[model samples]
Target: MMQAVIDRIVEGKHAVVLIGEDEVEKIVPIELISDNVNEGDWIEIKIDNDGNIISIEQDTQSTKGTKQRVKNKMELLRKRSKRNK
Candidate 1:
């Protein structure tokens, strides 16, 4: 299993995820996911030998931490944007 963060969801198509410390991005089909996931949610993904997603599950601790980090960055960006206005 590998840990990844959901970067975005493409509605009925797929989800883009960021993996590893280098933040390598991968696309996963929406149907492979077991539950609804939002951006910044951390997940554990299992892939088959052919590089197909077999399972995906949310990792609560990682998700919370990632969400907090994203929220903080967004807040900082918002403050910066307001100041530039």
Candidate 2:
């Protein structure tokens, strides 16, 4: 299983996926991604040694955690702004 994030969709045909801490990207056909997934979602991809995708699914926990982290960051930023004001 490979961990990746659905960075964005390209023209509704392919998805730009970011993998690992460095965010190395891979372009995958939209059909290969699970239907429930969307941009900014974390996903698990199973691929064979040949690099053919076997299956893909959304990583709900990772996605939720990421969203929460972003939300927290935004709240902190707003607090700092209010303090400055």
Query: Which lDDT values do the candidates have, in the order given?
Result: 0.83, 0.90
Per-residue lDDT tens digits of candidate 1, residues 11-60?
76799988777877889888776566787788998778887777889888
Candidate 2 contains a number of clashing pairs equal to 0
Instruction: Give candidate 2 regions above 4 Å deviation.
Output: none
Q: What tens-digit string does per-residue lDDT give for candidate 2 at 1-85?
A: 7788999999999999987678878899998887888999999887788867788888999999999999999999999999998
Model 2 residue pairs with clashes: none
Task: Name the lDDT of candidate 2.
Answer: 0.90
Q: Which ten residues in a row have the lowest lDDT in candidate 2?
A: 45-54
Pick the TM-score winner.
Answer: 2
Error of 2 at 36 (Å): 2.8
User: Which residue runs of candidate 1 sit more than 4 Å off their true CA positions?
Assistant: 69-85
Candidate 2 accuracy as TM-score: 0.89
Winning model by lDDT = 2
Q: How many Å off is the CA of 46 in candidate 1? A: 1.5
